[model samples]
Target chain A: MKYYGGCDAGSTYTKCAIVDETGKLVASVTSRSRINPVLSAQAALDEAVATLDDLKGAKDLAYLIGTGYGRNKVPFADENISEISCHAMGVHVVDPSVKSILDIGGQDVKGIAIDADGTVLNFAMNDKCSAGTGRFFEAMAHAFEMPLDEFSKLSLKAKNVIPITAQCTVFAESEVISLVGEGKPMDEIAAGIQLSVAKRCFVMAKKAAATDSIALTGGCAKNHGLKQAIERVLKIKVVDLPVDPQLMGALGAAEYARQKGLASAKA
Target chain B: MKDLKHLYYLENLLQDANNNLVREAQAGGRLAVGSVCSLIPEVLLSLPGCFPVRLRAPNTGSIDLGTYYMTSMSCECCRALLERAVEGGYKFLDCIIAPDACAQMNRCVENIDLLKLCDKEKFFISYSDVPMKSDETALRHYVKQMRIRVLEQLSGVYGVDVSDAALRAAVLGHNEACRLITAIGEYRKEDNPRITGYEFAVLCTATYCCPKDLLVDKLRETLDELGSRQPDSGKNFRARVVVAGSEIDNPDLIRLIEGSGALVVADRFCFGSLPGRQEIVLNDGEDVLLQICRQYLAWGKCARFMDTAKIEERQSYIDELAKSYHADGIIFEQQKFCDYWGYERALGSRVMRDDYGYPVLSVDLPYAVGTNAQLRTRVQAFVESIEIKNIQGKVTR
Candidate 1:
């Protein structure tokens, strides 16, 4: 009857995951950009507790782990781990064969290369620019006056895609508007946008030597067009797990907490 | 981790050497060269058996030396330079040499040192009369004072028997190293680049503390081996980029950038073009160390040292370097926690756009190896933007 809880507070969104002793995903929740991370973490904790109706009144959680950008800010967590390590561990838990994991979040993108045991060998990240991240796509969606879900769908329909050149968010927005004015089809423009993200991701993947089975996690992975575009350019099929990709970081943190808890008990 | 520990030890040794050199120079009553462009005078000090250390702060510390200056001391680099001097890091020196190369360095001497606000117990202030016109008479006078002061200092510390032959050889050795580094830089400009700008900088800085013979031989071998390696195919680069920022010490970042098919042709970092070029010439039997020291103090354009109209001048220099190198883009790398270049970010970006009509990418780097994917994406997209499609005679869309 042991219980484990995890939290992942990212720049754009915060996520939480709960798993039982048998590794069953009991409950998971995610909140958008507005809430403060401390509050967001509480919301996620509440959601996890609510999912376990029979164990709702159970106050005895075996272990809790906090991770991601705001892991240190999580007050209730028993321990904390870096998102870089947690993401690798979480992805490996889902598919142990995944050697390379590319996590594209709202503000940053990371490429992690891991060993069979889920230990990070070498990793690279991109936080300085927003061109290749979820934020870039969000900005593009805003310019097109489309919801993110619809935008991804429309992108798949483009007969001819026109590439946007500027890496800057402001400049790229203008380029999209100019393309719209030139009577370019919407789907093609969307495809071009996906292409841009893919190009940046490809550069990172090549640097990390994205070898063997690769996992695509993070908020951007939900985009069908982006996933397809990345797969095509990399010339490799990317594995997506059934568990919510956004929650993987938190799950890994929880798993780490569980292991530490068990080791201390043994000691 | 072992390499990092080794670097830590090396840094400590440099700091110790700097302190001892400054103390010996001051005790012997020699003038210190403290200008960004005072390479000649710095060399002269070394040749004359007097110590010449660049006034810089330890990479970490909380002492606010710039607090003694006025509110107008907004240039963080200039403020940091003054702070280093005030922190008693330069307490061992006999004289503080100030070159009038830049406005900030000039002001630091006139306002900070000349005002007698700094700790004056250890050092005197000597200003070089190197006019913008490069006056020979002024150079001779400065060289004479340098020699007399250094000789007096050597007599007190290690005795006056310091051989002129040994000093000349040291000066020639350093100058030759600079020549070899410059040659390496020239090699980087080829279509199929052999070495990177950051690697070239490492080779240059390693020479500062490393044995002269070892460095010279190692560099010669590296250059020969580099020359034999096949060049990167010039076909893939969507755009050529010039990288500028604080000294890029991370080899991983450089490899990531290069692997993205963008050749870095020029840079404004400490480890790049700065150390390679030889701008100062030493006169025979004219105290080679002093000549080099004075030139080192007078050299401007480093972000660390501020000069009159330096912002505009640096922009122009970057523009010219980009044009000469045929760079298609420019990446402005600003290290996190470095307050000096953060202020220059906006202006630097404008300079790249307005002056050169090139796309400028601003990268804020952390100490850790992060930002690889994001940088790759930004660079690739930039190249893809300018990608040209060749249309053969058929059209059907």
Candidate 2:
């Protein structure tokens, strides 16, 4: 009956995942990230705990692990782990067949190579650029005057893939505006944006030598259009996860808490 | 786990380019010769009346003005040095001896000279054409350049002795400090070394920034303290790594790596003790300058050495260090926008990991890594990966 917790305070949102001693996911919740990661973590965990009948509060969990960019600032976390390692473990737990992962988060992009046992073999990350990340998609979505989710889906209806040449987010946004002004189809422009991000991810994946099956994690994983584009670009299968892809980091942290808490108790 | 007695004092010495020791040397009528690259033989500058102080901009928070002048695309370290120069931080220098080894760094020195940052009446800057390939012809060029550019400037401008006897005397003092630093660095090879890498980096960096003669006694004492000092009982580090990279003047990068659970057992970067602190063997049969230039060319591992033999030698040098140090992996890092290291790190990391069969983590970091979470996470993940390889019995070593 013992429970464990994992909170991922990411750039754009805070996600919390809860699991039992056996590593069974009981509840998972997502909340908008606050200015302070500590508050964001507490709010997300409280929302997760509210979904379960047995838990009174986040304190009821036997152990809690904080992860992502704001990991060190999470005051209630018993431990902190990097989001890279967390994503590897979470994807491996959900699907052992995945050997590589492309995690496009709010502000950064990560290409991680993992082994069969959920150990990270190698990783490559974008260097201080927002071109091939969730932020890029959000900017494109804002220019299109639509919700982010609707913007991602619009790419599916594209009849032609227009090439977006700029490798910078600001320049690319300006290019998108010009394309819109030039009276290009909205779906094709959205398709170009997704494909541009997918191409950048491929270069990073090549750095890690990511071959075979890969999975998409982070908030951008919800974008089916981007997933298909990545599959096309990497020429590798993008495996499906039964759980929400955005909860992978939190789930991975929760799994670590369960394993470590049990090991501590036995010791 | 006990700190070295001189650790805090040495750390404070590196805070400013014009530190207490430099001031003391100046007060004692010694000239501070600014040096940029390891290509210029350090002993030649350490002649009787002058000392070599490797240019570094410690705690450089902003390089905006530097970027404005040098453009934002050059090496951050060079930009930071230029920034420090523009702020009149290097006004204490008598003359700067620069080499054409790196174009970006040369630009930094050129900017300093053009702007006349150092207002000392006799202040001058010498830019020499150093050879990249280490051959007999190149050695002759190196000797000639060091004589006309480095040696003649100090002797002519400040009347500092550059005689064979003076050079030999300088070598003796340099050798003494090198022996002490090398002896202290040997402890890192122990199963549980008495010294940490950050402590070693601080000690090593001080030898380069401060006058070598003044640090000899303290280094000797520190070496003695390490001989009997005991490490903490349990293993605090998860993995042992060799950090090979571009100029790492700041020790916080080492501190960050150690904080991420990897112990840096070997430092093969610029300003490190490996080749820089190795003693220069002398003989009565040869000219002191010729011998010194020959030894430095052999020790050249910088990526700027583009010859095929030197290129292969650089990778083998890292392999040799990893084996001798018993390191579990290698971290090949570079300063941002450094063209030489940008190519070298990409090729070297792969060659070490795939061809040499060692786990390698390649990264490009800023000039100063002050509580940088991104770099810390990269290092932590690398340590975990190495640990997992050990557990899985997949580690080749």
Candidate 3:
């Protein structure tokens, strides 16, 4: 059976997904992002291939699509599609009922409205700001001196919600420190940070006219606190994807490769 | 697409406010009347022995000083212009005739006036209270302001001719340039356009920045050259779109949009051909100044025109342009921090998509869009969405 590959060279990490002609995701891998997207993409694909018994490397793939911030820089990509389109496709393929998506990536947050067929009907994104993104959460976690997963878990134990007023990441971190100095509960502050991000994302969702249930994608999608906060602020349900949320971009790219590769093969 | 011969020459002219043609016009004993807003009737400033050079600070790198003075919260276009002034960029102009519109721009001009930046011995700045409402009362106020603040000032200071005959002659020259620019812009309506949006932007912007009479010959030749120009096979663009928004003195925004696979079929923004380059139809019976003011008032679609009728008309105008040009979608953009366009873009984005049944991409852009990756990504995604809709046979108006 022929195989397809997709690489998502995001700002924080490079993810690769390999799929068979039937669109089943056979193997996938994630690695820390390198400064150069090409190197990161190659590394991720090679790591993914190492997980399989038969596949050797990218050469074994029938087609490959590159996506995310470093999409154009992926040298071996047969095609490069924006992460917005890729996310929409990835989510639609996993769950067609998800009409909207909140993709909080490394540096930016996006609100995407999708059609029944996974086409991106409309989208809205934060411009040159990092208030509601993976980076923001990572920074907060770093300030709390804990791992990201633990930081997100700490948010669930909060007894009160402290509001984060500063829109800038640096300022918000300073505010978090001041709150710590004030002897406030760490879990409450953590919940506040998640809620701030959620509030910002709610504005984007409103702007994009997101409706029905929305899926959470990107690295931060794993943060249960953020998911709950998004649902609370948006007053809508956040649906779960069958696959890992962070792999959506790569999966969508791989799906496109499958479709395109099959069409060319038929021709 | 093949480059228009005059494209390079005109593009280079836009790099500096004091370009070769402006110098040539000044050296020939003509006054350079600097202008900032469209409400300041361009024809009045282009009277005999004077020409209007709409102030633009191209290749702007840092607006630190501008930010210090105007504060960072002011409109970036206003800040950039102020920055250029602080850098002695507008030293070539004789005077500035601006509308008392948009508070940020007003503060910018006020700072320039207060600083005495322009060192010309007879340098001056005139502020005219142009109307926001385009009614009969507004027309009279517009005409009266143009007479005293713009016309009388030019005639008084530089002894420039502001007579009815002079205004008539200026209108003729302005109309000639407008006709050429409009005719060139019309080619974008073709299924496969002969001219790219970037080239058309350069041509249209040149008419605004340089002396119209000086650029007329080149525009005429360029327009004639477009007659037999063939478009590329299968089309390079994934979709055709109309760009509507705030002032786009810099064409890099259009280039960025086009580079993302959307062919800009119509321009409905400031410094664009729609309202800026349309011919000023004249009458033999009425006063030339009164007639000019009336036409400009009617054409006012800027968000500063707070009237409910004008706001509704603005949306209708975009719909008409999109339908006429056969555009697949519309891109509503605004210069960041521009309060007028900020609200306009937000409202227009919703109305155009929900009411008009068009796929609209709304964005707020910086003044100089130099390969902004975020904007490019947005445009690329917008193009893909439009393509997908087309493939799905969705009737996107």
Candidate 3 per-residue C-alpha lDDT over A1-267 given as tens digits, one digit per residue, 9 for 90 to 100: 888889999999999998899999999988889898889998998888788777887887889999988888775688888899999899988998888888889999888888878888778888688778888999899989999999988888788899989889999999999999999999999999999999889877875577667889999999989988888888888898999999999999999899989999999
- Lowest summed lDDT across 10 adjacent residues in model 2 chain A is found at A204-213
**Model 3 CA lDDT for position A230:** 84
lDDT of 2 by residue, A92-200 (tens): 8888878888888888888898877888888988858888888888888899999999998999989899999999988998999999999999999889998988888
Look at candidate 3 and tell me the lDDT of residue B100: 93
User: Which 10 successive residues of model 1 chain A have the least lDDT summed?
Assistant: A53-62
Q: Score the docking of each candidate (DockQ).
A: 0.04, 0.58, 0.68
Model 3 C-alpha lDDT per residue in residues B1-397, reported as the tens digit of each score: 6787888899999999999999999999999999998889898988989999999999988789899999989889999999999999999989999999999999999999999899899999999998889999999999999999998898888888888999999999999999999999999999888998988999999988999999999999999999988888879888999999998999877888898889998999989888788889988999989999999999888899989999999999999999889999999988889999999998999999999999999888777778787888899899888888888889655
Query: For every model shown, what is its TM-score relative to the native structure?
Result: 0.51, 0.94, 0.95
Relative to the true structure, candidate 2 has a C-alpha RMSD (angstroms) of 2.2
Steric clash pairs (candidate 3): none
Q: What is the C-alpha lDDT profile of model 1 across A162-223, one tens digit per residue?
A: 88788887789899999989988888988998988888888677645685547888888888
Better of 2 and 3 by DockQ: 3
Q: Which residue ranges in model 3 land beyond 4 Å of their true spot?
A: A49-60, A181-183, A208-212
True contacts kept of each: 0.05, 0.45, 0.55
Q: Which window of ten consecutive residues has the lowest lDDT sum in model 1 chain B?
A: B388-397
Candidate 2, pairs of clashing residues: none
Candidate 2's C-alpha runs over 4 A off are A50-60, A175-184, A208-212
**Model 1 residue B47 CA deviation in Å:** 14
